[model samples]
Target chain A: MSQFLDISGLNARIDADGQEKEILRGVDLVIPPGEVHAIMGPNGSGKSTLSYVLAGREDYEVTSGSVSFQGKDLLEMEPEERAAAGLFLAFQSPVELPGVNNANFLRTAVNAVRRARGQEELDAVNFLKTVRAAAKELGMSPDMLKRNVNVGFSGGEKKRNEVLQMTLLQPSFAILDETDSGLDVDALRIVAEGVKRLRSPQFSALVITHHQRLLEYIVPDRIHVMAKGRIIHSGGPELAQQIDREGYTKFLAEAA
Target chain B: MSAPLAVTLEPFRKQLEGVSGQPQKTALEALHHTGLPDRRVEDWKYTSLRFLAGSVFHKPGKNYDSAKARAALAALGLAEGAVAELPRLVFVNGHFVADLSVTKGLFACSFYTADKAEPGSLVRSDREPLAALNTVLAENGVVISVPEGIDAGQVLLVSLGQADSDAVSYHPRHSVHVAKGGKLSLLSVQAGEGHYLHNPVTEVFVAAEAELRHVTLQAESDAAANLSTLYAQIEERGNYDSFVVGIGAALSRHEVHACLAESFAQVHINGVQRLAQTQHGDITSVITHAAPDCISRQTVRNVLDDRARGVFQGKVLVEQIAQKTDGYQMNQALLLSGQAEIDAKPQLEIYADDVKCSHGATVGALDDDQLFYMRSRGVPEGEARQILIDAFLEEVLELIGDETAREVCKTVIARRFPVSEEGA
Candidate 1:
């Protein structure tokens, strides 16, 4: 009966040298639990800014609007606080932390979220066991756990690392920020399957992507078309097929 | 004695005369006029000892109680009876405690004692003014020698300072010699509590075909000031490696001067300096390739938080005759707070046209995107920042080679990060 995540009239801007450029203008979105929604947009369409704003990056200023996650005021929380509240963002260009080993970093992250939820921390053995299984399902090698997080990894490996984190954290709501952008065909299939395995009645996803090719594998329940910082169209999965066929030329003409 | 070398040497000589015999005291007095290193000094510009100009010096104490020394040793976490197995040497307030030193094989007492017993046999050379200061003022120090074709276990040298008086200063000296075909590992630790100053100098000589691994751990008190200088000479076909880890003291400076005197010698120097609050730490090194086909690599990492400051100055010189030399140097610093400062300068002076020499320096905070990436993975902000910091310093720490030693350094580094025990 309640919305899992509700964003109403969200506005974001970037200030470069005394000038303010609006990135998001009066954007509204809603997604209930147990549903997957995709937002498809061209380059520089403010899709990444929306994800960053929702994740509370300090650089993006939210001029006005409200985002409620699980009935909690999302904007009022720090990025870490949002994460502890079961909010996840699968970055498009996941960062490479050279010195921190993958296993140790994952364990620390998982336990941090758990402690915030008033749960006991997992011991090292138990944590390693869980990570090993999840890493295997994501097609990650054992050596990946020993290496620094994403350091020297290929583009596809970084995407898999994000999926690995999602599987480990098991967050209630996840925002996949173009996770399929640089992945190969096999990696895309594996990542889509990883998301599919995580699907549940209590879990929801806001997948930001540009291509409908990924939708063929993940199969979003609904699709939204975003242009110039606002969603102009919302429909069933058929909308994705239509965009893939006709392209954004007709939509650009209509908006004009 | 022909108008003592410098005015600063007068008080130091008078102090040494009261603690030891004639020859030793005279040798120390001979080092007098070596001008005090100031900001104007080329190598000492970034680190100035001008603050020491006004301070009065204290003489070495004669009535050091063994029981008190033993208690201090235990507090440092040395296992009981561990000293007996170690080729151990102890210094109290810059003066050597002969009763506590154990020497084996070619290892003897101080250089003066060693030379007196066998003239022209000791490896002795004069270069730095501070080395002369340590010799003249040092009442107690060590001379360690490893015979040819022998592998000596790790030798532990502990320098302890007791500041029973107000603002006392001590200069300790050491001499180490490794013969041809010999292997040696030395752990030199400087620790003390009180308002005191420690100025220590060590000279090491590695013979042809010898290998030496040296580790220096400086954990002096926050109120103490420390100046340590290490000078090593590597002969033909010798290998020398030094790892210096600094974690304490209000003001500390470590200088390592390594010279490859013969062809085909190799040197590796790695250091990590972690400072917080009002602490100041410096790692300055100069590697000279006087012979052909020499190789050298240096990596220095510094982590500064609060108002702490760190300085790294590295210089690699390839002489004209030293063709086919390979040298690489890098210095990186992580500033956790806005007030923290890091000054790093990597220098290269190469005259050999056929040599490969490169140096780089970087000073920065944690990556913003990396921080958000970790935070989005459910890691708290503090923990996320710490992970990034750890990753930044991991490259340097991984060069330690020893797993246990690396782990110990890792623990110390982790504690430096702002992580609660509950979070750990």
Candidate 2:
């Protein structure tokens, strides 16, 4: 059987003021269906760059890499095509689309994905039913859905909106890009609960974070330490505990 | 300094004499000697009519046939036999076709005929020069008057454009009077498939404690040129709302000017202009506060795609006596293509001590992050861009209080942004 998401020798660079800076160097990772993997890294370790490359952002140039999702070439597809193929990336900093109502935008996105998969669009009644339930589960108020997407929303609300999109789209594989950064303890628990509700054999997630606080709630099956543009260590969930106890001081010295 | 005014006064004087009614003709002639508005004219700087220096246009003759007028109306989806309950006033090349107009209790005949009937009435005799120019040159105009304390139901004024074998120029005049304690709603639609020129002037007077709502939609042929001006005066305790939506012509200029002449009056103006290809559309507005405790809000949105160009110039002025005045203006444009251009200016001039006034103008392309966000949701790039564009313009469309009118405006904007075609 094919892996849910596979990345082999993924290399990336940043061009700054006429000089090339290597960010991700030959990073290899494999996420099988139904498993949650956590990637813990220090700053400048290319955690965000990996998410950008996976989501097909224009600025990031993948120097050398192969990314396959569910037996399809993920790197070749457009960002939207990747979304339709059940690949989702919960952005670290959710974008604010002023004047676009949150409920209307989510419905459009859901219908677009449905249409791509040869499915009929959801009517207003059915869409409201699905979204209202998810919003309730995520502790989001009904008024939040009526407002412009993420505009003037608190950091916690934006993270909740990301989770709301994840719940609405039901992607097979999701990349949580430091979604717990600005959230308080309560918000982090709510988001973790939202992810837990969506967990199933057909679903998988790659959680990229700097701290082990989020991993405590989501309970990843495995943890990997990344430094100096590559994954340096891999182990079970205890690795996260060790990192939480000792911090990245030892890892930084080794990386240097 | 006065030499240019004298030079400009010659043709206006000649045109004033051609105005029929004695009192109106005399007033126009006197104003003509005062001189034509030039660059010195605060409002005429951007739009100089010096282009009409040597051109002579004949006053339209009443040689229009009822059958031809009906045909023109039918072509505009306003068929004669249709069961729609709209008060339709048909204008053939700026002349009113009485056979096609439906006038009831409050709504009267065209402006010329109304003025002829009610010559000494306070409303008819009070005419400006541009209005007088429209009067002498207009083949026909419409008047919708709501009596004191009476609510005038929705009124739809349809300006039909009918071109004879010879190219023609038309100036259609419209005057709306809302009496004290009255309410009025008017939808003015200008539709024509001819290659003629249409210059329309509409004046609205809202009395104390009255409410008036005016919605204007213009969809002239691509080969036609349209110039529309709307002037409104609001009295004490009155409310005025105006919206203008235009799917651009070869050259389209729409001007809306409103004066809060009395205390406790309010004005709201919202407009949208959509242009494609070589089309040029301009929307200019001025709101003045002459009395204390008045409020004004203006929002204008323009969408220019392909090689189209759009212009929006808005101003809000509050005099010293107009204390406690609150004014806000926002003008935003979406340039879909690199070649498309937009010139937007929002100005606020307040001489009052205790007044709140602000203005903002922005011209930009679609947000790249928002575009990526939409694209990442499985919407194609073209569709994503179109969605953002629609959302951008919807800010203005939402100001229209009527649902049907807002839907019509949205449909017209959608057609201008075709997802299947590039640079459209």
Clashing pairs in 2: B95-B140
The clash tally of candidate 2 reads 1
Residue-wise lDDT of candidate 2 within A1-256, one digit each (tens)? 2777889999988787878889889999988899999999888888888888898887777889899899999889989889999988999989888778899989989998999888899999999999999999999999999999999999999999999999999888889999999999999999999999889999999999988899989999888888878888788998888998898888777766
lDDT for model 1 comes to 0.79
- What is the C-alpha local distance difference test score of each model? 0.79, 0.78
Computed on C-alphas against the true complex, the DockQ of each candidate is: 0.78, 0.60
Give the candidate number with the greatest DockQ: 1
- Per-residue lDDT tens digits for candidate 1, residues B28-96, read 444544456667778777776654555566775765767767776665554344434566677778766
lDDT of 1 at B161: 74
Across A16-44, the per-residue lDDT of candidate 1 in tens digits comes to 78899999998899999889999998888
True contacts kept of each: 0.89, 0.67
* Candidate 2 lDDT, B1-424, residue by residue in tens: 1223356545333333435656455545554555545667665555555544444334456677677667655544454322235666667677766677766543544365535623223222133344444544554577777889988767767776655554456777677889998898777777675566678877788999999988888877776778787788999999998898888467777877789999999999888888888888888887899999998988888888788878888888899999999888888888878999887777788899999888888888888888887777777777777777777778778899866556555655565445752212
Badly placed stretches (over 4 Å) of model 1 are: A253-256, B1-34, B62-77, B80-87, B95-127, B411-424
Local error of candidate 2 at A138, Å? 2.4
